[model samples]
Target: MDLKNVDLNLLVVFNDLLNTGRVGQTAERLGMTQPAVSNCLARLRRLLGDDLFIRTQQGMVPTPYAEALAEPVSYALGAIHSALNQSVVFDPARSRQNFVIAMTDIGEIHFLPALMARLAAVAPGVSVSTVRNLSIDLPREMEAGNVHLAIGLLPDLQTGFFQRRLFGQHYVCLYRHGHPLDHPGGMTLEDFTAAEHVGVVAAGTGHGIVDDLLARMGVARRLRLQVPHFVAVGHILRNTDMVATVPQVLAQCIAGPFGLSWCAHPVSLPEVSIGLFWHSKFHRDAANQWLRAQIVAIRPDGVDGGRTEDGATAL
Candidate 1:
């Protein structure tokens, strides 16, 4: 068969035939006459050299050849339909989309409560799945549509990524409520350096960001223990006499419940900013835009600041 001579409408007829089975129903669905559908099916049979559908009292049963063609033909037509409908308005309230987000546990602690409440009230049918972005290949995941958004401090994104800064987190010193340093004046520089510390390392090795900043200032804390996750800090601080220099958000999150109190860090350190990131492949995608808008709307201060170097919204 000549490729250029083949009628693509015949493929559409074949797809509808595979779906509805009865020629009358297929014609009604395609908005065509039954005779026109039959003609297209006949042409499809001749082009493929197969009787495609066998008419029986049980309705039209697909032949082995038609059954083999079913999946690819359906997928191709679905892709084409999606491509043509790219500009359609996305209605989140009725959509059953599952948005996958890549984030650290810290990000989950700070972001999930409000996000879930918003989803429950607005887009209830939309579900969310979270994957920790430790060492995962995020660029490949985003490009393949496996990851919809990445939340938290992702400083290593390559060229095609977009981001929006949600807030900046300053460093603070967290310790048990009564083990001494909860004075009115807070811990002094000497008292901070002398205290035994609990270190949380997200990088899986070496010291944390606080340590690097302190090292630059010719000061070092006595780190008696080190852990990889942020959740452990509360328990460790509550039971032990050790102190932790952590992001203010995390310190505040774990402080009250664990009988811990936090004060401003004695040393100067750069504030860590958290952001929402996604691949540019989804920049103009309607559903993605809806989700991003929801996130931006609930930002802590509800203010649009400046833009980051990579064109991310800063707030």
Candidate 2:
């Protein structure tokens, strides 16, 4: 097959078929008549030299060849779309670009507000959407052009992507401002273990780093609740005597607004390194570079005015 002779639009039909499983539904999704979609699929079959999909009792099922090609083909289409949409020179003041980012709730609380403020001053028309960073395949997502940027503590990222360390976040113990723990100067390990706790277990498998650290030291707390998101932990801590361990930056941000007080975690926990990540394909992209520079500039400075081992500012 001559690759140059292929029309890229066939991939669109291919993707639609894969997603919807029925020709009629695929046609509706692509905003094309059923016959047109069928014609396109036929052409695709001729070019690929195989029946990409077969009629099944359930719906249209992809052949083994189609299944093998799905990810790479989708990535190719997405990259082409991004390249075509790329502006030669990005003027934030006048350009209207919608950026999608994958980040944790903690990231939203600490970074997004400042980022939005900067965007408002520069590119008022620019918009951003945040999605949950639950998947471990972020590098693949970046390569596929599904996500423009990702921000979080991804310590084990593979090669072929660029990462800029943003900051180091340690754990902090948080409780209501007037809680009994606030009677003295600060909380001690004994006070922390004695209190009722609300554990934020976003991943659902293991106890958080704080809890893990305590367990290593043979200390355990009365964990009254476990929630998926840090936001819920804050809500519960505000209304009850349940204390929770949260990222220091996130705790600082919510402490004032929610009438919460924070102290350093009694047991030493590993600091999470938050960073900005992007694909290497976008390394020389002018707009991507500009956005990256702006993000780095807006990040908070280091504690000792030097970068940490993870290349982020010490917090």
Candidate 3:
């Protein structure tokens, strides 16, 4: 694997081939002839000592080896692409840079509206994309510039990244307004544990702490349904007797639309700290700094407006 011997264009062809799985389609995307794509694939086959894609009647199916190489190669290409496209001067008002953020469904519901509103006012051309990758390695994605920032309570992102504390939140018991359980007195430990609950199986988030905290307190929830995300929880609670234990920010976000009410958790759950995480790799990238500033404004408490790790107070 001598880097000096390999052609960069071949890797680009390999990536597009791996995505499109056809010489003609790959050529169409890369603006090259089919022969050129096939030639590049040949060079890649010799370099890697494997037939990366096997052509079938349907399409080119990746071999086991190619499957293994797909993610890393895409990341490498993405890092190179990001590096090449980095702007020296980021004028948010006119720049059409699209920032990719990694967050959970909870963040989409809770953070996006405020963020987009701010972006529309200041940087109308700046676009945003959000990804919720529970299985993804956040650090690797950030390192490759695939994800510009991650907003959540991802403890896994603690090491090898710079983060700004956006807010800390506690769990709340959310249910419909007219439910039998909804009361001025709020949820008691008995109501929390005995009620049929919709347990959100949010794998890579701070909400997991709620279940752990309940376990420690010797409390049990009668889970009637389990879901992977929180976007549907409020809807479910609106129509069913099930209550959900979720972050206060999320509860607040969903409450109005679904006619829901939330109260203090009876079981004394610890506050889960949420933050804006970014790799130091793009700390000084002007576009990155500007986007980070917009996110800091949408903080749950909306007070802390300071310099990010990039050392930029405002764009």
What stretches of model 3 exceed 4 Å from their correct place? Answer: 1-87, 305-315
> Which residue pairs does candidate 3 place in steric collision?
none
Tens digit of per-residue lDDT, candidate 3, span 157-234: 754467887888888889998988888888888877779999998987767877787788789889899999888898
The candidate that wins on lDDT is: 3
The 0-to-1 C-alpha lDDT of every candidate, in the order given, reads 0.79, 0.76, 0.81
Q: Which stretches of candidate 1 lie over 4 Å from their true place?
A: 1-86, 204-207, 306-315
Could you estimate the TM-score for every candidate? 0.69, 0.72, 0.72
lDDT of 1 by residue, 102-194 (tens): 877776777788899999999999999998776666765664467888877777764556778788878899999997888889888999988
Per-residue accuracy of model 2 over 1-315 as CA lDDT, tens digit each:
678998988988897677677899878767899999999999999988999999989889999999898767765765665587566778889878888788888778877889999999988988888877565446555654567777777544545566777777788889998999976568888998899998887662122555677788898989999888887767788899988888888888899988999988887888876777776556556677667766776776633325432453211
Give the TM-score (vs. native) of candidate 1: 0.69
Q: How close is each model in CA RMSD to the real structure?
A: 11.8, 5.4, 5.4
